[model samples]
Target: MMENRNLFLAILLSIGVLGLWEYFYGAPQREKAQQIAEQQRIERGVDQNAAQGAAPGAQVPSNPAGAPTAPAVVANPGVTREQAIAETKRIPIDTPRLKGSIDLTGGRIDDIALKDYRETVEPNSPNIVLLTPPGGPQPFYAEYGWVGAAGTTAPLPGANTVWTQEGSGALTASTPITLSWNNGQGLTFKRTISVDVNYMFTVADRVENAGSAAVTLHPYALVSRHGRPHVSGYYILHEGLLGWLGDDGLQEIKYSTIEEEKSISHRAKEGWLGITDKYWATALVPPRGEEFTGRFSAVTNQVPIYQTDYLLNAREVAPGGSTEVKGELFAGAKEVRVINEYQNNLGIPRFELMIDWGWFYFLTKPMFWLIDFFFHLVGNFGVAILIVTVLVKLVFFPLANKSYESMSKMKKIQPELTAMRDRFKDDKVAQQKAMMDLYKKEKINPAAGCLPILIQIPVFFSLYKVIFITIEMRHAPFFGWIRDLSAPDPTTIFNLFGLIPYDPASLPVIGPFLMLGVWPLIMGVTMFLQMRLNPLPPDPTQAMLFTWMPVFFTFLLASFPAGLVIYWSWNNTLSILQQAAIMKRQGVKVELWDNIRGLFRRKPRTQE
Candidate 1:
């Protein structure tokens, strides 16, 4: 009994701490993150809510530890993204998946908006602007230029160097656009920028050496974002600079990490690097089979500037000869299919890692693949989740059955257990020994019940990873009231599902727990039903944990994505049915209804 109590207490404490942490810490962190995100949105829109391309899929590798030093950021105060867009002569980017423009001032693919996704679930909501211009409040833009080598006196095309558009029509997937710049030192640099039907941009730069002497220069590409964007704050999902560098494996550096380290440099023979938000990414893919240096850095002084850049080996441009280098840029949604396509078809090294598959890549990726496959068949992500939950139950059926069978035996021997307790009422240790002997004689494993929890933990975490990390799950809707499976259920019982005028989330102290959503309540009830399949633990503390666990999870999961809560609810319902069936087949009385009714029934006053 002591050992059993210790085990139950440990389990209760572990679960209680996790639940409490989510309520006390996770919820507040998310709220703080959301507030920061909202403030960023307003600041970004403070100047029309302003606005927001690629090179060919380039191959990989890096230079020396020398990364391009970031120039001091002079933020364009009071400048709207609209004004910035209008300020420059831009080459319009009108792809089927994207619609924006390429700023000709620096010849940077600075402006872009995803035509398919929106800021909100509303169909007519503003398009999700992925990149913005330099003058914008939260400036996120990509640049391609050459770094001057030792004894190189010729000027190169840079951020301040304005390039004139060579052709007329807008930059489409089929028709590439060319921008040319003259350095006056007889160096004629031309950049041919092209885009595929999707998010990949092909930037091929050619430098003609029409001068008298040879010039040595290093070709480099970088993605820069001025201000830190709001992160979801969930540790499961990485929201910062990340990429797969050759030999270096995968480098995931958070903004805070970069700030502390100043800059992280890597020399790779083949790889790519980029800055990523939860759903969106902008990665620089250097051409294949090349030696280059990749750097993830942060410059914080007036306005924080975070940059992910790569510098390639210097190319010697002989007199009257030309040198050309082609690089690829991925600037849009990190769709699994497209990212994999680029990874496989283009020979980019482990490019799919850009999606933040986490440490459980082996399981998480396959889980996503299964969920995606089912989604394609069902046409609704929520239905797909239900189907996957059922499939998971089936896969673990034999283990679950054995566990339930063991629980059934324990439940059947409850009368003997009660008699044993009364017989050894004075000696607690002797009572535990008798109970163990009975358990051995009946061939029942009391610890078998923990199997369900063990199975649920991994499945639960993996699903949460899929829902939070993948863009496909974003904005996916279920039936009534659950519009975005990626977001928490909108309707809360605290405000009577929003019938009341004020927000319960705005209240003090208990506000976070009050966010109990409908799906969470359903999940809690299902869990309660499942727990009642076996008799309550004889110990009061153990009994208390069993009784209150459902409520604890219900409150904790209210802040989780709706899809996860839905899965838990469906899984619990299945477990209840499965356990009840196992107990009935074993000729044991299932105490579900009796235990439930006993909770509410009045007890006769005890004679003192």
Candidate 2:
């Protein structure tokens, strides 16, 4: 009983330390982080009122004045996205990863949807819409054109201008589409649009001077998203305008900040700029090595409009001589591998930065690579997670072996420790001195047991961040009721594991508290069994604290991602097996079964 009390006290002290650390440090750190985030939002001018009133799928109307204005307030003539698409004569865009059309009216690359990804995990859910036509309910699209020099008599393509398709039939990866528009003043503008198997669209714009004189014009491309879209509001994720300007590194501007600042401008030798969502992004990559000015702006009228645009230096088109400008539009999923490929092969600078790897990039990226490697080997992400947990344990085995050995030694010396306490009951200083002497004599470090746990905290957080932010984990599934590993475990205990027809999550106040799922319960049980590997505390207070730790953790982790919970449970089980083996090698008796039986056994009553 005395040995049990010492072990229980040690565990209880560890729990108390962790609890106090979280309360005094972790809580305030989180609050400070939130405050910092709030300050950043304020600095960027995130206006709640403007965001609420912003119309979706709206675009800036063509300015007849030929002067650049805020794209948000420019009223699109179409009322609905479908109506806008129907109103225009378009060329169909069909590819393995994309399905949409090229609106011939202004030769805009709009009406795009990601063919491979859906809105929900359901098989029949609609594909995610990425780009929409102008004049639609949500006006988000990309357009390329030439800006004539001031006082030039050439007419450039505006929103109302209709361009005729040079060729017939649908545009495929093999066949490119060409659009031609001729101004009566003797300038012919031809745009050839081509797409690859993935999400890249190559646009080559050529201008011919049929007139007797030369004209100077600037080639420009703009991706405008009218109205503020919904954001996940997670601090770890960035949903806004992002780009790599030459030598400027990366620039990110939130929608609200655009509204507050009106516009952000930068001059780069060459680069790409665009608006990004949590999963998808649309960016305009100008010709490399060319000098251009990039701008991100927000305009408010009926709705807020966000636009990312770049204008190249003015070029002279001599009589009968044509000048061409080549650009690429990336409108698709933020797939890390695909983006990295583009960055390497196409020379798109810092393209992989689009995916938020967070501050722990060093750990998060390698962890993802390991998990991804195991996923391919196992053919299931759930199994991959389990395999990765075992691999992590193996890597830390050396350190953990020493820690567990120390714990075993401490457990064996618990009786001596308790006797020392009794021998010095009236002198606390003597008791501590005797305990230290015994510890040094036995070569035991009481703090060694916490080393493994201390190392695991960061690894655990990094894994959570990776699972939460990566697109591969978006709809990943495990066995049974775990369909989306990134999402919280679906099966809750309150409804008797789905035996009842009610959801506890719907109840007010208690809904979240009652959301304990199967995975969490399994995790709690593993933790409890792992703790029981050592002797229990003799003191009732310490024993009760140790007993309740697992329950507390089970409820706390119920809302975490299913994959994370699975990893925790598996890690706990592995630790239990490891400690048991160590304790046996140290000639210490395992007391787990004894402790389990102790719970059911009644204590004898003492005569008063």
Measured by TM-score, the strongest candidate is: 1
Candidate 2 versus the native: TM-score?
Answer: 0.86
RMSD of each: 5.3, 5.9
Candidate 1 global lDDT: 0.82
- Encode model 1's per-residue lDDT on 12-82: one tens digit a residue: 75677487557645775876577587656544543322232111111112234334644333346567788
Q: What lDDT score belongs to each candidate, Candidate 1 first?
A: 0.82, 0.80
Which model scores highest in lDDT? 1
Off by over 4 Å in 2: 1-80, 425-429, 536-542, 597-608
Model 1, TM vs. native: 0.91
Determine the backbone clash count of candidate 1: 20
Error of 2 at 295 (Å): 2.2
lDDT of 2 at 231: 69
